[model samples]
Target: MSDFTTTRRSFAKGIGGTITLAALGSTASAQTAETWTTAETPTGNTLYDVERTANGVYAVGAGGIVLHRTDTGWERVLDGGPTGNGNSLYGADVTDDGERLWFVGASGAIGEMDVVSQSVDDHSAPDDVTNNFNDVAVTGVAGSANAYVAGDSGKVYYSFDDGATGTWDYTTPGSGSAVNAVDFYDARSGHIVDGNKSVFATDDGGTYDKIGLADANANFYAVDSDGADDVWIAGGGGMIHHWDGAQWTPADTGDASLRDIEVAGDDGLAVGGGGVVYGRDSDGWNRQSTPTGQNLKGVVRGGVDVAVGAGGTVIER
Candidate 1:
């Protein structure tokens, strides 16, 4: 889903149950990330993606709550959140300038959190034509600005500029598959993952083209660009696929149920349903052992690597 929208975004279905911190992966213990501490959970449910700002760490999860973590500790900015029955919150991302922060999940539920005032603007079902938002990205497009949220039913919601609210001209580029993840280097070019293991790319931001991956039926939750030329995908079945300007290649992280991935540059980190982290390099893939048993939902680079998920978890490496 969103690359982890397993971090998956638009595809977070309104399902019930406790997601074990480490149940859906390769069943192997990784190296130790002992220095990492688990951030307090806002609610006891699935948390997709997180963003680090100059003030604090803004994390959104089920039950419509926004959790803020400063240098001191974690606290809830808003108590039980948005007016919706959707309990699934999938993917989240902030602007490059950290001015706008957006969260998307099941039923097309999206919450844009203002970092300065900590105010929120919500878009849910009815406001959202399709209620399956899995992941999102904020890009500076020519005619568009703000950010864009992607989800199931092949729908993408565009923001006005940066993270401001705007008209959502939902468009299904080429295919009708559910988009688990979305990222854009610019307004014109971006990439998305459908339910299948395949990946789609758009050069004009209008039409999307299909690209083949090594694994089939592999559910991808997260994706990021290493410049516009290099792309990476993390998904279920321990599948880690990459594109190097030319073609997509498979890089085995040794776990099948990979949840999400993100890149600071060519360097990236992959997290799975298991408590594992895979760092890929020129030679091959290296594993990082995590502390808690919780499945790592999302990975992002600020000063360090931050992985977040269930059981009130947040890990930094």
Candidate 2:
């Protein structure tokens, strides 16, 4: 195992409210129009992931913070739950129609929030599971009962009835790798990336097949699919892999640990450690200037591109 595996695993298990903003400033880049702008957040806690909801954008982070973007700015919609553990929320996803939101975080905590009613339901992990849930992926259609949550120790839980009726079915890919992120092209097909620098795909929502990679040590932190044929995976050591329907291939982005990525149409942006931000277009990948030096953890494509990171940093284009 790589040295990062141990350190990242420890970091994931540790819980704290303190967040330090890095001193690194924006680096010189080719795209110099200053497309990115910083927005104010309610807390300095580290934000792990962001997703585009129907009404606007929602960011999840340390201390169970959930910030919703309004027409004016960002607002804290949810703090620590009833237990007050303030378990850090790691990843979140919105249903395709944008009516519901699902989030996963520390100690296998799962939450579902209604976009219209603004009601939230906090669900606890089963007795046999105690590992932190790192990410979640929901189906595309409204009232869809299928959703998948993945996390530490290759643990994965599938809720065929949307956790409203039956209990969630669980499975592990047996890689024993910490599943950092998951994305589904549809209800039946999906992909997962892990801390062991491995990737897997599932078609029946249960069994997964390991996908071979050019670099065996590439620690993937995030995965997204424009379609089953077109998929992108980003990770540590500045690694980005593209799956073109059949196989995975490397895409150059220097040696930076990319924590999250967002792709829209033919354009894509990836942000990560050291305030690193890269944009890809028809021309290719070009480094983009970030306003803050904090490690960017999550990004989403919308009317404007927005990226969030440590120390309550929010950057929009």
Candidate 3:
């Protein structure tokens, strides 16, 4: 593990108790104050993940659908996903340069897309391991970035050579529990959360060490890492956990299960069941009224906050 010399700080100390927006009543007032609005989509398939790149925002989901947000509106860029098999895409991340988008999904499917060209390269089932990949993180340049894939088989499959079959390797991070999500801060450092309620950190890109949430009752669904010290994890029971280098602090926002979270500097957003959208600002995390009741599965913070969920729902702020 590389040495981290920066002073650690905890932002959760200022987090107040949970505030349920529904209980606030006055739909008239809430509607006017709402900042999130539903956007039209090309498909009714459920979207599992969304990502922001230099080119634009991309969303992937069931039926191998890849939707791109253009200057005009949302457009279907890839209808059959990366494999042309229509496998449901679950997670995605952009290369450090923001020119390539890598996505992983059901049936061990893995693909890389040239954001500028809209062309895809299939690198699925690396090393003949066909376990369903739940999430993926790519670091470095577009064509040769390291790819780390979270597997449902409790292992993390990785390729230092842009997911080339021969360069692929695997590591078991948790106790045979499904690895749900993975995110990288750099080429060789990142974090992964599993169904076992464990969060593991890897500094050298291979070996992993358990970091926090050892006794968490809810299953961790997603993780976003700014660095070893600054990480955000969202999971069931509306719980979001943060690692501030020295310790981990968890706060419960409400009853809805939080499926995904993204943090950039001091701002962030978390989305999950029942169209729940929680925004994190200088004050800490708080619930925000949304326009849909559909369960949200994925969210991304780019030029704007975009979230996608069940019934082909897409909302933005």
| lDDT (0 to 1) per candidate | 0.62, 0.73, 0.80
Output the better candidate (1/3) by lDDT. Answer: 3
C-alpha RMSD in Å of predicted model 3 compared with the true structure: 5.7
lDDT of 1 by residue, 129-155 (tens): 657777777653222354667868866
TM-score of each: 0.80, 0.87, 0.89
lDDT of 2 by residue, 142-164 (tens): 46647788878787788776765
Query: Of models 2 and 3, which has the larger TM-score?
Result: 3
Top candidate on TM-score is 3
Winner on TM-score (1 vs 3): 3
Ten residues in sequence with the least summed lDDT for candidate 2: 1-10
Alpha-carbon shift of residue 237 in model 1 (angstroms): 1.4
Off by more than 4 A, model 1: 1-34, 82-87, 125-130, 141-144, 159-166, 214-217
Ranking by lDDT: 3, 2, 1
Instruction: Give the per-residue lDDT digits (tens) of candidate 3, residues 26-49.
Output: 212233244898899989999999
Q: How many clashes in candidate 1?
A: 43
How many Å off is the CA of 42 in candidate 3? Answer: 0.8
